[model samples]
Target: MPYPFRLNAVASLFVAIAPGAFAAEPDQIPQDMNVVIVSGSRVEHTSFDFPAAIDVVDASRIQDSQMRVNVSEALSAVPGLVAQNRQNYAQDLQISSRGFGARSAFGVRGIRLISDGVPATMPDGQGQPSAFNLDMAERIEVLRGPFSALYGNHSGGVIQLFTRDGQGRPTLEVNTAAGSDGQRKLDVNAQGSSAGIGYVLDVSRFETDGYRDHSAATRDQGFVKLTTAPTAGGKLTFTANSLEQDGTQDPLGTTWATYQANPRANEIDSTDTQSPKRTIADRYNTRKDISHKQAGLAYDQQFGDDRLHVMVYGGNRQVKQFQAFSKFLQVSPSQSGGVIDFDRDFYGADINYAFVRPLGDGKLTTTVGLEYGHSTDDRSGYENFIGNTFGQEGALRRDEQDKLKTMDPYAQAEWQVGQWVLTGGVRRTKLTVGVNDAFLSNGNDSGGVSFSHTTPVLGALYKINPLLNVYASAARGFETPTLNELFYSGSGAGFNFGLRAAESTHLEVGVKAIVMTNTRVNAALFQVRTSDELVVDTAIGGRTSYKNASATLRQGGELSVDTKLGAGFSGRVAVTVLRAVYDEAFGKVTTGSRLPGVPNANAFAEVAWKDKSERIGAALEAIASSNVYADDANADIPAPGYAILNARFNARQTWQGWNFKEFVRINNLLGRQYVGSVIVGDANKRYYEGAPGRNWMAGIGANYAF
Candidate 1:
């Protein structure tokens, strides 16, 4: 009776009729096209032949857009993915793919994040996007749908970033930019290749007097990469990155009343007792400071039809935050604290072997891999006040040691026939988590939980002709509870060992078409049924608790098109429509209610003009989305939909082996006021994070090649 069930029937019927409908005729098949993707299979394949819904944001787009501050700047057009800049540096960007990670209050969850073959996401499926250095990024690949199960746990989808390697002659470049709201940035980099070695190094600093009061922040980052060839067929790459933030303020969310009255105002204290109820956030000073560093090495070798790949990486992160909690909540002995402190060290290693051999008039490629990862956290909480002074660490309320380890072994095979590609993969994942509670004044609460699951995937891609390709896939995906979710117990102390892993069955069908030499279109229909879906119970004072619900069903469709409209003009469009709802009721939740933070519809379109010489270009873009509920109850609040316009202009010139470029961009071109993100189910009733109005940024850069 509902949309999910109806969509399911339609998708099944389409798949059943695909064979005969596509077998009518055969045309000359084109060779490898212009696009190649490695995210779908962990191996390179043509875009149309990948049998998945994947989008590639190339380097030109990344560099030309306003992505230096946030990745969402370049990802607004991607279908089935919602990337929003919260404008609050404390929590980073809020990203969700088809309702998978909409509940994350901080960082990313329920998705695997990879950068240059190294895992950016820890074993527990928690990731921080602040560590991403987009200034040096080459491209970003987003993969959704069934085949993503091959990446192991938390594979609702996968976002992989690939950085460019040094090539051609040596070059040095510098960039500087400034804009409204006191925003400024400076970046310097050098890249080159010589002999048998290639190197890239970059350093940057960003500072902004944010649009909201008391929201200014500054960040510094450094990155380095090196590649060398030792033996005949052996290559090694080393990478290191670091980030440091200072005075990153948290403006916090606002209630509906406060938003409509004064969007820039902080949360007010109703019980202050003073004549004028003053703002609490400014008085208490909510802020977060972070430092992170990571390094990794990868080695690759080939022997005839067999290839081996090995990678090892490690990182450390430290965080300290001051919250806006009042002293009344600290009286309870069970209360952790208003201030949070964390120190974490993580490391991992991966090894894979791939063999390509002949099999029955076709080629068979088999891959076997082993992955191991471990992480340890020294996490603690303290009162936000010491005597009469607030915003300082007081008495220690909680201290604990949390550790997680995971091991996964996987195997995959692909058989390429005349016009069909068949693929299959399986992965067995084992996870162990434990906690040692050090603060035992109240009681001794230390426990652990273990989770294991075997996920499998099967897929097929048929090339009906040079103009069309169709694909279908089925898989199983599993996600374990994140470390943060295991921190506090619902009733008493200790880790929530009672929490269960969320599992899902995924099915998808898709089509890719090349209508003309310069026009491309892609579409996909997908459904997922998840049991033991994690639902939020409460969120207060920067802490949240989660519990499992009975089941949820999510069904969706996505369409994207890119075309060369006319002479030197190009256009693109992407649309996504989805319905995610609880299939079974738990407590006060009713079945068929829409999922929180996930809109039913989203769309984006863009048009650009550029000369054949590529010396000048301009683009106009528009984005829109439907309303979304703010909580599971579906009655607390609703985040209204919005439409926004953005524009960009660029020009470049070359003189004496030196290239110079100037660019400018305007966001929220209409100066529209809107809510950019929501804090789902906030117990404090602070739900809406407001977006800034029209803003402009201009920059210039120069590079010299020798």
Candidate 2:
């Protein structure tokens, strides 16, 4: 739908423009030959190597794109994808595929996330959604499917984000930027190979004044990668990912009356007239720090009937999480309280084997894997108020703890002949959960363990012609409740009751084709049926508790296309359409009901023209999303949709017509007001207001050869 130009002319009197942007284009470099065996394919060979579709984001494009601080937004350059944040800089993100989704604080739905062969997820499978260092990223590979057997530990498909290996020429780079709301950034990266060893190091600092009132965010990150060769047949690699940050929340929270009066009011100003005495000091101030250590070894060699490939990995992940604030004046301004501390640790090991054999006119590939892991969560907290009466010596002190362990095994096989391929696999998992609560009102141990049944994947891929192929597949996926959801009771984010397992079955049919000599497009249509969905039962007469009364259905299509515009110019575009619904006893909703934060359709387009010899280039891009549902109840009030247009100009030419090896980019050329997403939807079924309206971000980048 197009907004009337005439209306815009009249509305200009009251509107202030804040500008920014989405666009996807064809792959920059086109490959004419080879049936590349991509990882997402649990299947072995053929043009449509795997029944489930896959997308890859390589390094060269990452650097050329001029993407800002939003990792997910930059990724929109890839077709069939769109991403947005829920909070200003909370690093909390939501991603969807084929219109199906599972909303959580971390990890992702129907997709497994592994970085450097290590599960990026914590022991509970709750992943850290914002720890990425885009500057050092080597490539991002995605596998879409419910075919979970290969890595059944997670029901979603798999997305592997590989850090830089520092191949070929030695490189040293520095990047800096300044944008709207006093946002600033400094990023540095370096890599080189010497003798028989290679090394990579990177560090960065990013800060923002925030879009809305009290919406500021700051982040610091550092990473390193090392490679060594000992024996001729083996190699060892070590890496670390870490971050520290502090941020203010949003100004968009509002009660029904405040929203009706002014949905755009900041948190400190919005209020219920009945509670006019309320003070803003009670608002929340949050912060966090996360660090991980990882290392691994791999061996590959020929062994009779098969070429052996083996990899073993182990790592430790630590999180220091904090949240607190004093001053809910209306609830009790005299009362000041918060959680003093929370800590957790995760550790794990993995072993994998892949063997291939030549058979008939085709080939056979078999893979076997084993995993053993454990997690521990220990917490202590305190709450105090300026009340008239004093209670006991240890009245407000409390402690709680939980531990979990998992041991799993899985296998799969693929056989291919002519244009036909077959694949099948299964996985069995064993789990145990234990907990302890020092302040248990019932005076009891508060922990228990549970095991999940087996989940499997089945699919096939067919080649229709040299330029195209088609596939169909079916598989099962599930999610277990988190520790906080089962034991914590008093904290607002804490849970009073346990949640049941969340499960779904996905079926899809898709096609992959090279549209022309320089363009390729991949598209898929999928549907999912889910049961035992976790939902709040306020009717239980207390805080939100989990129940399995909800059933859900999702259906959608994804299309991505990329092409070479010309010698030094290229472009890409992607679109997604989705429908999700929740069918519970209280409300039997039909299809087309949108999921929380999910837009009905998302699209992107980008074009870049470069002159490498002169070290000069310019790029233009546009990204737009349709309206989205701001609440889980599928309410009528939606987050109005908006579009962003951006442009960049870079040059390495010297002042005297000579040339240097550096360039710069400017973003949000036109300022515009916009919301990040219905990301902060309330239970009342309304959307949260978004961040700073107009931002002007500019950055300079350079690379030098040793």
Candidate 3:
């Protein structure tokens, strides 16, 4: 479809919805709703009152989504953010805010991820979101734009998940679901409060046959939280969580010809020696097995108008992965082989003090904080075959230990002056990375790099009317190379000390308004200019290198509307338009070329119907995106524009002290055949990953209280 045609379709729908948006029955309007955000300010502030682009996804939305396996399920309606499920479990989700983190092959970068006050992103900015437990999530807050820089490195944006604390009486709940492609999931949870103590615990298991060949996975997760008030003005909280993935298949990407032949086909065909009659992913057993455990403690106390908060957290992760490397590549001495093993230990602490006092007729609040974090990695690589035997570790290729440490001092202030609010923050970060080469066979190519930066943001919001606010902000942010990026230097087995950090300047202006009694609208315009932008230097046989580009530019706008229709229907729509391109060329990439892995335009719309009795409900959703490029050269095959329709129906009943509910969701109702995601800048041009056609899932749950 043409871009203009798609825009027209979306515009027509907006016109059709305007009637209901403006036709407001004051008496029918529900009480004004205010969402409190914690990610942007590390404090509580009404969403509209916050001078940034922030979005909140509540538990109800998460529980009612079709694909609860990833954050993409509930975030489709959020503008300025793109989340794609690759259907290849090994790579996890492909997430990007604006033009940031678009080139990542696996895991997330250029964005900060937090869970219940604990950092999921390491000091190097690499993050994994597979451990998020949706069953117990109270809310997820997404902060974008300049204010995100306050979080230090890789602060292009922030996604923070806060779980629910136990309340009321002791209760138990169980949930189970089954879906297309032989997917199954089960969850159990318990919560209660007693003797000034509150507790919540949840455990879940999931398995899938997957949508493509050689794509299958089984996963387990557990979470627990305990909270108590030990003194009159003090509170303490402890949280623990663990995740395990026994088998996650890596289907890998496919070439344009191969995708045209069979989108589900693996990289290797039937003539390879590894199997002679099977695909490479199946024959070589390309997969990853992983285990992770994390725990954290938080303390809060108040003394008159001054407050104190402290947090301590630690975690460890172990992973083993097998890849499909051709025999020719394995013959080279420089090749790192196809088997990877890594164990990581990370720990961090944060302490802050807040003071509130009177300034003139208004009030001024100031916060001072310090944070420290450290991580160590024991990494090794080995050949995937020995003699005629495949799928087993052979000769050791690379072995090393890498360590990263970071310390930051930060301060922020917010002042209320009559009809205006001023906010500002600054953070000074110091980071050091070191490596030790343990395998003398490759020579001692060990070296380290250190980086330091100071980022600051300033913003102001003016309340023109009781229901309208306008704000503008600007900030400087920087991103250091991730540990994985530094793992290999083209010269040999050593750190990539030649790589430089990318720095950016972000500017944004936005408005928030209550257009009607039951209608709200928010919009923002943003621009970012980056120096020494990171780009893929080389990618060969599953191994990659990175370098810095001269410059890049990103400009975009986002619009969102939420309104409550008459009776029990509510509707929401969000649209994003972006123009991201290289300002200066690097290698074969040319100036003015569109950045890879980002769609120029995307939109989401949803309408839901519920009853006052709260026993029955239904929802209809639509998601659409423009075409996206898969390579920096802008000439490799592109994923075409696509639209998907989904419907969900749910109902619940209460009897005695027990509650029972059921839900059914149908996705891709139009049976759309399209590419779901891509691996950016694949040297062999194997970049496409296909999405599944029409699928369905049904779930049932029961809760009992005493």
Candidate 4:
């Protein structure tokens, strides 16, 4: 089928399943309309009245009958959001929102990440989703489109996880899970409240022998949270968490030929004259070790109709990694070697005050705030071979001290009167980056650069009736190059300070409505225009250099429908259609070239059933995505589009003060061979990351309350 026709068909299917297709049933209205969200405006408000696209994944959807290891397992149900488990733990999950962050080779960029009112993204706009503790998450809120600009820098979108607070009776819980390919997990947790103070503690360990060859990993994590109310209208919270991983093997991507021959096979090292069968990963022992620890404190006070909030946090991270670069590549004097070692220390704070009052015939709420963040990294690089023996660190080639700092001051106001709601906000941000080169034999690359921008957003909503709302929003945002993006120029020179930050304009129109009493629907149309957009100039042996492109355009539509289908059954569907392309030609990339790593269309659907007591349940899900390109020129063979089916069953029982639950899940029921993700712009043409054909997992949990 033609791409345009296929896209239109998907859009038509979404409309057919949405609420507008059915007649309204006022008497059977569901209570979900009362759900409250705390994103976009930083205040409690129903999503139905908000002038933006926002979705919430509740605790049940995140934990029930799931591995609860990777956030991608739950985020797939959100439209306009693409989350993939690369099956290579060393590299982390690949997540992108509305075509943004799709070109990232490792970790996450372009989007903002937050946990428990603390920023997870660094001041340089890079983030690690692996830092989130899924077991303790109460809910995750996703905000997209123009309203996302309110968060300041690199705000392509916003994802925030809120942890559950300890309350009620003291409880102790234990959970264990085992899955295909030697995957296993064990977790223990305790929570209670005493003397007006609440506390929660959690510990977990996970090990996997990976679905692909030469991939294995183990992870240990610990978390603690404490809460107290010291005065009449004052509350304080403290949270701490740590994650550790040692010797996690990295299975680099494979070429199309290798993937077709054997989906689980690693790339062979043709240059290894002594061992013809050895793979590049095995030759260099590509692996990573990581240690991360963080702590945060938050205080909130209420002064009648006004409120004040303050948060402070600090963290440290250490990483050592070995890449599969051949020894011959390091002969260049300017080369940074193949082994990377870095230790980072970061700290940040946020303070905000909100005032509520009456203006004219409407109620007005205003917020003013300041945010500051800083980070320093001690980094060094070395060759991955010693005396002709591969897999050993040798001969330091680079050393440096890198620092980043950011400050932002912003204000926002919202007014509501009768059937009209209006909102406006502005933020001014300044970011500074400095580098001190210690290994100067290659040349002194020490330098500093600063970037500043002022972003403004405006939104308006009209309530056509109690059941329907239409809104529009517009904003201006910007994203600066991360520390890693500044490491090398297109010509392999050090410290590319000449690179400029990308600026963007966003516009969106959306609708939220309840048509049939038990059915709710949300749809949005959005467009983004960017200048000085970043693109990969060259990528070799895990080292990538970036350059700015002329202009780019991204336009898309998202639709989501949720409904209770009666008789103990429910159904949900989410669909997205996006067109991302370069608006002007640059170098070898032509004007109409599609953005690499982004699919033109994708969708998810699910149907579930439960018994009256909610003690037994079952569900079936379908997921699909369109083909994706691997480079700016679209010259290589694209990853083929695919659809997969999954099924799960769960049971629960209660005895005395103890509750027990067990679940079993099977994914890729048809045993299909497909690429789960891609490494964009790989110089070696090793872009395909294969997904597992068929897999199964089972877990059991017991909780006792006293």
> Each candidate: what lDDT?
0.84, 0.57, 0.85, 0.90
Ranking by TM-score: 4, 1, 3, 2
Q: Give the candidate number with the greatest lDDT.
A: 4
RMSD, model 4, all Cα superposed? 2.8
lDDT, candidate 4, 135-200, per-residue tens:
888999999999989898888999999888888889999999999999999999999898898989
Candidate 4 structure, TM-score to reference: 0.96
Q: Model 2 scores what on Cα lDDT?
A: 0.57
Return the top candidate by TM-score. 4
Instruction: List candidate 1 segments past 4 Å from native.
Output: 1-33, 274-277, 327-336
Worst 10 residues of 3 by lDDT: 1-10
What tens-digit string does per-residue lDDT give for candidate 3 at 28-138?
A: 444444577867677677888889999898888888644357888877888999988888778788889987888887889998889998998999999988867778898
Worst 10 contiguous positions by lDDT, candidate 4: 1-10
Q: Give the TM-scores of the predictions, in the order they appear.
A: 0.95, 0.82, 0.95, 0.96
Per-residue alpha-carbon lDDT of model 1 for 601-688, expressed as tens digits?
9999999999999899999999999888888878776888999999999999999999999899999999988888888877778888
> How does residue 110 of candidate 4 score in lDDT?
89
Clashing pairs in 3: none
